[model samples]
Target: MRKPLPFGISVFVALMLLASQAFAAPKSDLWPMWNQSNEANAASFDHQKWQQILDKYVVVKGQHNLFNYSAVTPSDKALLDQYIVDLTSLDPRNYSKDEQFAYWVNLYNALTVQLILDEYPVKSITKLGGFLSFGPWDDDVTRIAGKKLTLNDIEHRILRPIWNDERIHYAVNCASLGCPNLAQTAFTGENTEELLNEAAKQFTNSDKGAKIDGNTLTLSSIYEWYGVDFGNNEQAVLKAIDVFRDGQKLEGWSGKIKYDYDWDLNQP
Candidate 1:
C-alpha cells in the first residue's frame, strides 16, 4: 500500500491545474460593437447565462490595455457600476496574453457607453470636454481586471495587437450614428470571424454608409478614419469597399452627401 500524498501537496497541484485551465480559456464572445440578445431592448440581466458565456473565455484579473478599463457595454455601464465587482482589482501576473486583450476591449466599450449615458441628452460627445480638456473617451481613469486602463488603451494596445486586421475598426463601434449599429449580442472569440465579416459587409453595403449613384459615390467618413485598415492604401481600401458596394464600379460611383453622426444613445 502506498502512503497517501500530503494534503498540502495535493491541494497545491489541484490549484495549479485549475489556474492553468483558466488561462487557457478566453473571456467573452467577439460580438459586434452593439450586441443585444433577443429582447435586447429589455436590457435584462441573466447572470447564469452570462457566466456561461464568460466562462468559455479566459479571465485576467487586474490586466488592462492602454486604458485602465478591460470591459464595457451599453447595458454594462449600469450593471458593472451597480453590481459587478471591480474586475481591475485582480492581479495581472495571473492573466494570459489573450485573456488580457479580451478584457481590455470589453472594458473600453463599456466605459464609453457609460460616458454617453452620463450625459444622454447631449448632441455630441465632443461637447463632453471638461477641466481635463478632453472627452471621457480620452480619460485613463478605469482599471481592467486589476490594472489601470483608458479608452485609447483598449483600441491601440490590445484589439489592434491580436487582429492587426483593419476590419476590426468597423466591428468596434463608439456608440454614435456615424458608427456601425451596435449588435445586440456579446462578442466572443469563438464567433469573432463571423462578427467581423458581418460588420464589414453591413457598413460597406448599406446606402446609409456608402452608396453608388451610377458611379457617383457616397461614402461614410469611416472610410476616412483609420481608412488604412480597409486596405494597405486608399486604393486597396476602395477595393474592400467595392465588395459591399453591390458590384458598382468605384470609378463612376460619385454621389456626395454630408456625413452625419447620431448622438443619441443606441437604444430602443
Candidate 2:
C-alpha cells in the first residue's frame, strides 16, 4: 500500500547517511587509546639521550628554571630531533600505564623545548605557528602511532583525560616564565610519581604559582583557564593548591581570586 522511493533517490539517501556517519565519528577514533590492557609489557624505552640534553641545557637560577636555547649546539639539536622520532615511533598502548605516562610527559616537554629551540631568539612561545593560531598547541607537530597530534591533543585528549591528575598541570611546561619550571631531569616510569609530586610542590611554593597580595589572592592564570581540571570551583582549586603549599598559610585571605600569567619565553 505504500510506495517505495525511486531507485536514484534511495541511492542518494544511502550515500548521505554514510557520509553523515563518517563525519559524526569522534575525533578520538583517530588516536590510539591511552591504555589498552591492564597487563603491561616490561619492554624498556630509553630516555637517556633526552635526560642528557635536559641536564646540559636546563639551568636552575634561584626560583626559576631557564633553558639555554641560544647555547644549544647543532649536534645537540640533532640529538633532540632523533629523540622525538624514537618517542613517536612507539605504540604507547603496548606499555604499562606508568610507562605510557612517562612517555607522554617527556614527549610533550621535549616537543615544547624543540619548538623553542627551532625558533630561538624569540620573545615568547606564543609567537610561533600560523597567523590565525594562538600558539603551537594546535599545530600537528608530531606523529604517534600513525596519528598526527598537536600539543593540545596530547595534553587535553590523552594525558589529562587518562590520568585525571591535577599534578599533570605542573608536569607539562609551556616554556613560559609564568608556567611551572621545566624540570632539570627527564620524567621516567621509575620516577614518574616522585617527579610529578616534586614539580607540584615546587610550583605551589613559588610566587608564579600562587601569591597572596594583601586582601586579594593573585594566582596563575592556569587555575582560571583549567580550573575545572583541578577541582571545578575556586574553593576546590585553593584546596588543591594548599595541598602543595607545605603548610604556608593564606590566613585572613579574601575570597577574591585574581589571575596573572607571563608569556615571555623562559630563556637564560
Candidate 3:
C-alpha cells in the first residue's frame, strides 16, 4: 500500500508541476512549407549589410560579445531596417539548404536585434512581453514569401525541424548575456559550418555555458531546456558538451547537475 501525500504537500507538488509546464521549452515541430528547398539553385543572397552591422557594433568585452545597442546611430538603424527588408523580400525556399540555413540564421539574429532596438533601454528582452506574454518571440516580426513568421516560427518550427542540427542552438542569438555570442561576422553558406564550430567551442568553454566545480557540474539552462536536441539525458548532454570543450575531457563527476541562465540584455 502506498501513502498519499498530505493535502498541502500535494498542492505544492501540483503548483510545481504547473510551473514546470509553463516554462517548458518549445518543441521542434516541422512547418512543411519551410522544408521546400531548391538544391540545384546556385544563387547567393547578399549579407554584406548585416556583416557590416555586426562588424561595427559587436565588440568583445569579456568572454561574451556584446552589442552596442545604445551606440547605433539613426543612419545605421535605417541601414539595419533596410537589410531586414531585403532579407524578408526573398523566398528562401528557392535556395539550397546551405543558403537557406544562412538566410534563416541571419534573419533570426537581425530580427532579434531589431526587436531590442525597438524597445531599447530595457534591462532585459523579456520586458518586451506583455503581462500575458513571456516575450516578443510569438509576435510576427517579419513576412517571408507572403507568410508572416515569428521568431519561434523561424527557430522552432522551421530551422530546428528542417535542419535537425544541434549546433543551430549556438547560431541563434536571443539578445541575452547567457546566450551564445552573436557571431562577429554574418553567417553565410560558405562560413556557417566554420562559424557554428567556433561558436560551439567558444560557448562550451566559457563559464556561461558550462562550469565544473569541485564535484558538481553546472550548465546553462539551454542544455536543460533543450535536452532532447543534445541527446536527452545527463550522460548524453555531457557527451555533447565534451565535443566542444576546449580543455580536458569531462570525467566522473558524480554530483548534482544544476542549470542557470541570465536573461539580462547582452548590450553594453
Candidate 4:
C-alpha cells in the first residue's frame, strides 16, 4: 500500500507548478542579435539609457541598436535604417581586440536585420533581388563594426576564423521572417557563450534542423547549407547537432534531411 502524502508536501507541489508558471529568467534570452517578438516589442529601450550604458561599458561604437535594447514592437524598417546609420558612424578601429570582435558581430547582424526590414512583409528574400539571388547575402553594402563589409565578409572573414564557430551562421539571422526569430537582444562580450549556445539549441531543437516524429527525423536546410563545416557530408552535421541535443538520439539520422525555407520577414 502507498503511504499518504503529507499536507505540506501537497502545498509544496502546487507552489512548484505555480512558480514555474511565473516564468524564470531564461539563461539564453540575452540576444547578440535582434528579433521582432511581442515580448521584445513591449520594451521601450530609451536612447538616454543607452548613452549612459556606453559611458560605462567597453562598447566599440556609439551607433544605434548598440544600446537600443528597448524591446520595441514590430521592429520595422525604420529602426533598421537608424541603426545602420549609427553603425556606419561607429569606428571599431579605435577599439581593443575583444571590443572590436563584439562590435563586428553586432554590426553584421544589425545591418542584415535592417535589410530584411527594408523589404518588410515579403514572402521570399529572393524577391528583393534584381534577377537571380537569395537576397542581400551577396550584397557588399552591409556594415560590420562600423566598416563597410558584405554579408560574405562578416560570415567568412570575421565570424568564421576568429570565432571558429559555425553556430554563428545561425545566430546572425538574415531577418527574412522565415529566418529564426530575430534574437530579442544584442550579443555582448560578457555573455557570448550563453547567447551562442542558446541560439544553437533553439535552431536545432526546432524544425530548422532536427524534428521528432516517433522515430523519423526531419531537418532544416541549415544542415545542408553548411554541411562542409559540419563534415564532408550530412553525417557530420547530424553528429554536431547530436552533441547539443539531449535525450533525443541521432539513431537513424544520416543527414538525408528535408529542406524548408520561409521568405517571410521573420516579423511579428
Candidate 5:
C-alpha cells in the first residue's frame, strides 16, 4: 500500500487548492429569493442621501475619480451608516426592476466605501482580508431582509445574475485604483442605464482599461477575471468592448492579449 502523505504536506496541498478556487471569479448564479420584482410599484427609492455622500467625497480627476477617505467627518460617516440602514429597512423585492437596479448599485458602492473606511490607511483593499485570504469580498457586510449578505453576494449573486449585464463590472467599484472609477453621482432608476453606458465608454477609453500597442492588446484584469460575462472567447470579448472604444478600434489586426490589475487603494 502507498504511504499516506505527511500531515503538514497534506494540509498545505489542500489549502493551496482552496486558495486557488477562492480567487477564481464567481459565476452568475441567481439567488431566486431576490428575483421577485413588482413592476406595478411606482414608488422610487430615495438615493439623495447616498448622492450627497458621493458628491461630497468623490473627487473627479479627468476620466478617473478618487474618494477622500481620510477627509470624511464622523458626522458624515454616521450619515453613511444611516443611509445603509434606511436602504435595508424596505423590502426591495416589492419594488420595480429599475428601482431594484439602482438600489443594489448604490448599496454596493456605499458598502464598498464603508468597508474601506472601516480599514482606512490600508495599502490595498486586498490587505483587508484575513490570513491566507485575498480580500474582504467574501466577508458578510450587511443584512438585508433578514438575509446576511457579502460584497460578493451582492455583485455575483444578486446583481450580475439578475441583470445579466456586463456593465455591472463598471458600476460596482472595488475600492481599488485598477477597478473602474466610482461614480460621483448616485445611481437612480432614471439614470442607471445612462451611467452604465457612460462608465463603459470612459473605462474602455482610458489607458488603465484597455491599451493597444502595435499588435499587442493589453486589457484590465476585469476582462480576464470575468471574461465569460463579456463573452468567453477573445474575439467575442473584443467585440463586446469594441462599441465603447473611443480610439482606433481593435478590428482587423490580430494581436497578443495580456491582462493586469493594480490593487492600490483608490484614495486621495
Candidate 6:
C-alpha cells in the first residue's frame, strides 16, 4: 500500500494531470454554426456595385493590377461604403457553399481595399493598425449574419478551414504586389471557380509568382508560408505550380527553391 503524499506534492501532481487532460482535448471548431449543407438561394448577391468600383479604380499596369487609390472619386467611395453595407446585411448561411465562398472572398478583398483607402499614401498594408498595433487583420471590421468578424477570422477561421482549397489563396487578394493580383472584376458564385483558376494560372506565369534563374527556382513566399495548403512539401508545391503551367517542365531544375515577396502597395 502507498502512503498519501504531502499537500504541496499532491497539489502539483493534480495540476499536472489537469494540464495533460486539457492538452489532450480537441479544439472546438470556431465556425461550428456555419450551415454548410444549405443549397444556394436564387436570391443573387448583387456585385454590380463592386464591379463598378473595381472597374473605375483598378488598372492593369504592365503585369500588376494596380489600384488608383488617389483617384477614387467621392461617388466611388460612397458606392464602396454602400456595397459593404449591402454585404453585411445578408445572411450568408442562406447561400450555397460556392456563393458563400465568393461572398467571403469578395468581402475580404473589398475590406482590404477599404483599409488601404482609409489610410491611403501608406507604403504597405502591413502598416495598418489592429490589436497591439501588429496589423489591421485583427480589427473587427465588419459583421456577417450578426457575428462581428476580423479579416483574419474571415480568412483563417472561415475561408481557409471551410473551403480547404489551396486555390483560395489566389481568390482573396492582399492589395500588395507580392500577393496575387486582385481580380479586375467582382467575384460572383457563378464565376468563382473560373476566376480562381484564372488567378492561379496568371500568378504562376508571372515573374512575381515564379522565376527560374540558372539553377535556382524562385517562388513567391506565399508558397513558403502556406506550402501545406499547396501540398505539404517543396515537390508538392512544384506539382501544383505545374498544374497551372499546363504540364510545362522546368529543365535544369536543381530541386532548389528560393522565396521572395514585395510588400509595396499594388498602386498606380
| All candidates: TM-score | 0.60, 0.86, 0.91, 0.63, 0.91, 0.85
Q: Which ten residues in a row have the lowest lDDT in candidate 1?
A: 60-69
What's model 5's TM-score? 0.91
Candidate 4 at residue 180, lDDT? 48
lDDT of 1 by residue, 93-196 (tens): 34443333334444455556556656665555545645423345557657644456555556755566445776656656565555664433444534556766
Residue pairs whose backbone atoms clash in candidate 2? none
lDDT of 6 by residue, 101-217 (tens): 888888898999899889988998867875224357778999877788988788878887788888888888878898899998788889988999999998888878888777778
Each model's backbone clash number: 52, 0, 0, 12, 0, 0
Per-residue alpha-carbon lDDT of model 2 for 1-268, expressed as tens digits?
9899999999889867764442110122223365463345887678988998998999898779998899999999999999999989888888888888888989999999999888888998878887634578889999877888988888888887777888989999889999998988888888988999999999988889888766678889888778887776787888888888875555345578798888889987
Residue pairs that clash (backbone atoms under 3 angstroms), model 5: none
Better of 5 and 6 by TM-score: 5
Instruction: Give the worst 10-residue stretch by lDDT in candidate 5.
Output: 246-255
| lDDT pick, better of 3 and 5 | 3
**Per-candidate alpha-carbon RMSD to the true structure:** 19.6, 10.4, 4.8, 19.2, 2.7, 9.0
Poorest stretch of ten by lDDT in candidate 6: 20-29
TM-score of 3: 0.91
* Per-residue lDDT of candidate 5, residues 40-132 (tens digit): 989999888888899899988776798999999999998999999999889999999999999999999999889888888788888786776
**Which should have the higher TM-score, number 1 or number 3?**
3
In candidate 2 the C-alpha lDDT for residue 42 amounts to 84
Best first by TM-score, ranked: 5, 3, 2, 6, 4, 1
Error of 4 at 63 (Å): 30
